[model samples]
Every structure is written in C-alpha cells, then in structure tokens.
Target: MKPAIHPAYRPVVFRDKAGDFAFLTRSTMTSDRTTEWEDGRTYPVIDVEISCASHPFYTGTARVLDAAGRVERFEQRYGRDGGRR
Candidate 1:
C-alpha cells in the first residue's frame, strides 16, 4: 500500500524440465535469465523441479499403500495367539 514498499510484480515463467512443462504467472521472483514469450515479450524465467505436470497425483501415477491390509495380517498372526486384546 505504501510507495516503494512493495516488491515489483512481474510476469514470470516457471519451467519444469522433467515434464517438459512451462507456465506463466505473476510473481515477485526474478531471474537473471529471460525468454521471449508468445506475445514477443521477454520475461524472467524460474526453473522448478516439480509442478502439476510432473507431480505424481496430477500425473495419475501416485502410489497406494495397503497399510490396513498389513495391519489385519499382523493381528491375525499375533493378536489372536496369546496376545493381549
């Protein structure tokens, strides 16, 4: 709200090399490197290791652990045989 107290807001590009994905968003972050966008304007670029494109959940490659099944197996093996309730 104060003059010169807020960081400069600018359009920046986030690149996910692993997933070959890139997106543009406004941020206070800056980069020494820049690239010309589709509109022919150069903007600061930020490299990200993980994004929606590369994330397991977003990519539909998440792992499901069977913890409940494991617990049942443990109870059958130990809890019923001289084990406390």
Candidate 2:
C-alpha cells in the first residue's frame, strides 16, 4: 500500500526447460533474461529446475520407497533385538 517502497509486480515468465514448459504470470521477481511470449511481447524469464509439469508427483511417475525391505535389511544386520547383546 506504500508508494514506491514495494517491489514492482509485473508480468513475468517462468520457464521449465526440461519439461519444455513456460507460463506467464505476475511476480515481483526480476531477471536480465527475457523471452517473447505467445502474445508477441517480451517478458523477464526465470529458469526453474522443476515444475508441476515435470514433477514426479504431478506426473504420477513417483517411485514408491521400499520401506519394508529397508526395515528387513536393518533387522538382518542388527537382529530383531537391535543387537543389544
């Protein structure tokens, strides 16, 4: 609500190169890099390592951890009594 004290919020682009995905949204973040969006206008672009498009959870490609197997291995190594003896 202050005048000129807050960072400027403007249209920017978030790019996920690995997923070949990009989106335009309003953000206070700035960048020297720019890209031409679908609207033929240029906007500051930010490169992100991961996004919903490429995230395992969002893509339903997440690997289920074998917790039972790990527990079995640990028991085998230390015994059921945790090797207290």
Candidate 3:
C-alpha cells in the first residue's frame, strides 16, 4: 500500500434505473452525480445500462435462439445441398 499514490476507495452507489435497483458498495470510480441512499447519506452514483436485477440471465428472461428456424431459412436460401449444382 503506497501513500496517496493509489486511487481512493470509498462507498458508492450503483443504480440500474430500468430495474429500479440500487446498492451501496465500495469502489474507486468517481462520478459527478450523487444520490441520497436509504441510510440518509449521500453517495456518488453511477448509472449502469444493465445489472443483475435487469440482466436476462439473472432474471431468467433470456431469449432462446431459434436454431431450427435459422437452419430452415438457410436451406431455403441456398437449397438442401448448399446450392451446389
């Protein structure tokens, strides 16, 4: 641990607006924005596009790719024997 050479590690808030979720945690990242947490304290807030709360895997809303449909479409485009003769 060096003196004053390392970035400050402090409590910050990560917010997922789409999911309406936020959590307090320590981070070295900084933000000009601030928000009042549930504990009645203000902390730097970082807005994220996706988090566990809104992620497909975590929420179990992942889309299953239609591989069979894709194969059918490809065959239709190129013929059954891959457009050879």
Off by over 4 Å in 2: 68-85
Separately for all candidates shown, the number of backbone clashes (residues 3 or more apart, or on different chains) is 0, 0, 0
Error of 2 at 49 (Å): 0.5
- Across 1-85, the per-residue lDDT of candidate 2 in tens digits comes to 9798999999999999779899999999999999999999999999999999999999999999999999999999989999788
lDDT of each: 0.90, 0.96, 0.96
User: Per lDDT, what order, best first?
Assistant: 3, 2, 1
- The total of clashing pairs for model 1 equals 0
True-vs-predicted CA distance for residue 13, candidate 1, Å: 0.6
The deviation in Å at residue 70 for candidate 2 is: 5.4
TM-score, every prediction: 0.79, 0.77, 0.74
lDDT of 3 by residue, 1-85 (tens): 8798999999999999779899999999999999999999999999999999999989999999999999999999999999788
Q: Which prediction has more favorable lDDT, 1 or 3?
A: 3
How close is each model in CA RMSD to the real structure? 3.3, 2.6, 3.3
- Rank all candidate structures by their TM-score, best first, as comma-separated numbers: 1, 2, 3
Worst 10 residues of 1 by lDDT: 76-85
